[model samples]
Target: MLPLAGERKNAKGIIFEKAYSRNISRGTSTLKRGFAHMLKNGVVMDVTTVEQAQIAEDAGAVSVMVLDKLPSDVRKAGGVARTASIRIIQEIMDSVTIPVMAKCRIGHVYEARVLQETDVDMIDESEVLTPADEHHHIWKWDFTTPVVNGARSLAEALRRIEEGAAMIRTKGEPGTGNVAEAVTHIKKVNDELRAIKAIYDSGDNQDLIRMAREFKVSYDIVEQTARLGRLPVVNFAAGGIATPADAAYLMSLGCDGIFVGSGIFNANDAKERARAIVLATTFWNEPEKVKEAQKMIDERQSMLGLDVNTLELRMQERGGSA
Candidate 1:
């Protein structure tokens, strides 16, 4: 459950204080980001139905994201994609003990508002759905529910954070079943972080300012990220991850967690695949354990991967700009 408004301590020992005690708003950055912190090193799986949500929970998913259609199905449908039904979100929330998340089209503030009112544990201003606005994204701080946004680079991630996004996920090409783009994104973020870290270590404020200007984000965030050597929020890997090896590879790349969409349900062995992914993600550092997880599902049962280079719709580009 989300922490209620007040100076209360959560189960993980994160203290949530009212940012504005006199105002009705309840979501402080501490509360929002702390919710994401609790999900680190776990898998967040996408499910369109209550049964699938149960399957994910049984398979050890830390949370379930409710969607109207899987990312692959949304790609094939080729029309305006929107938020999941309130009934379905409510049903899934009732069915699962773990946190429940739902997506709203990028920049759809009202959709986010509705999800918050529905008492969802988290809201994803996702690129998987057709974007509702092109020039802007929702100012997430206005809402009491935490928001997670996707980013392809450090600059984009910082922009989202500046707009009050509590968590960030790599904007890998969704529904493609190809992990290449996801790998590329995380690596790029890592490389950029290293660059900024080196600049900060050299104590070159001028160069840091230049880098911030180039990245098009605030200098404070850039410097803070440089000082910390990582994203301020939990950074998860999403999009085209189909195999246990794929999950483990992303984990090795320093992702805090994984978000599986269209990978498990699109395959022939959802239950087994889901469990395998969870196992691989949890024991990513142990090679033999990962190998055992790899053997749990047959390779032939995997989803047919799409070449991201040839995709007609590049979902990752949605809501990319500040």
Candidate 2:
């Protein structure tokens, strides 16, 4: 095995090893997917500064996503959004012991390449940033670092996975601080998964093939997902997740993990909210524990949420068709 760096234990006592077999190679499908699996049932928070990254780490976040601006600030700023500064990404990586992730614009291969060269633990080909390519996303297989992409349906998720995305997240309307869209998305993916599972179970190969065509993914991958009854990769709930209840509710809906963007630092009680969301995500199955976590933050201190229907920019739709 080839040992890497940044080995650490999660709040659940899960030891994440930065090691992989040399024969399999560093960015092979198994190693990339395994990197995401290590973060299952944990929270990944977005932060623009080393201070916020440190807070996320101290709050038991599995990893911190470095961004040039918080999603809310991005929406308000309203210019072309790009990747965070390499210096800032490296600074945050140096500040924390946990793995660090940074975002690159969709379809911007060079941006992804730069992030990979920065040695970030992961790269998010995120819609939250202004997409550089309108009809094509970055071909993720070309990079040595694992990449994560967002999806609102099974088809999008499957297509990204087919393109070598190591992880998938729901493209909830980012910066809204509203969990409604995220809920709708995961439910839609679940509904589609159930439909495919039934088709696969009925011994209908023709129907499975047709479904694969409809999803725009390979038959083998569609069949694999149907047999498993879940995503082929770790699926996390993200965008506008503001409260402990929001985190717990999404977990109950069967997400492998949670991603908080702009929800923490935008709120009045960032430190408490960050820790509370992590606690709620970790103990989502237990109502009493979740309630304890919810009490840790005051609602009045939460980020001011925007109505999804009234938003001018629907970030979720950015790279859906691409």
lDDT of 2 at 184: 97
lDDT of 1 at 226: 91
Count of backbone collisions in candidate 1: 0
TM-score of each model, paired residue for residue: 0.92, 0.93
What is candidate 1's CA lDDT for residue 202?
99
Model 2 per-residue lDDT tens digits across residues 137-202:
887777768889999999999888877788999989898899999999999999999999999999
Best-performing candidate as measured by lDDT: 1
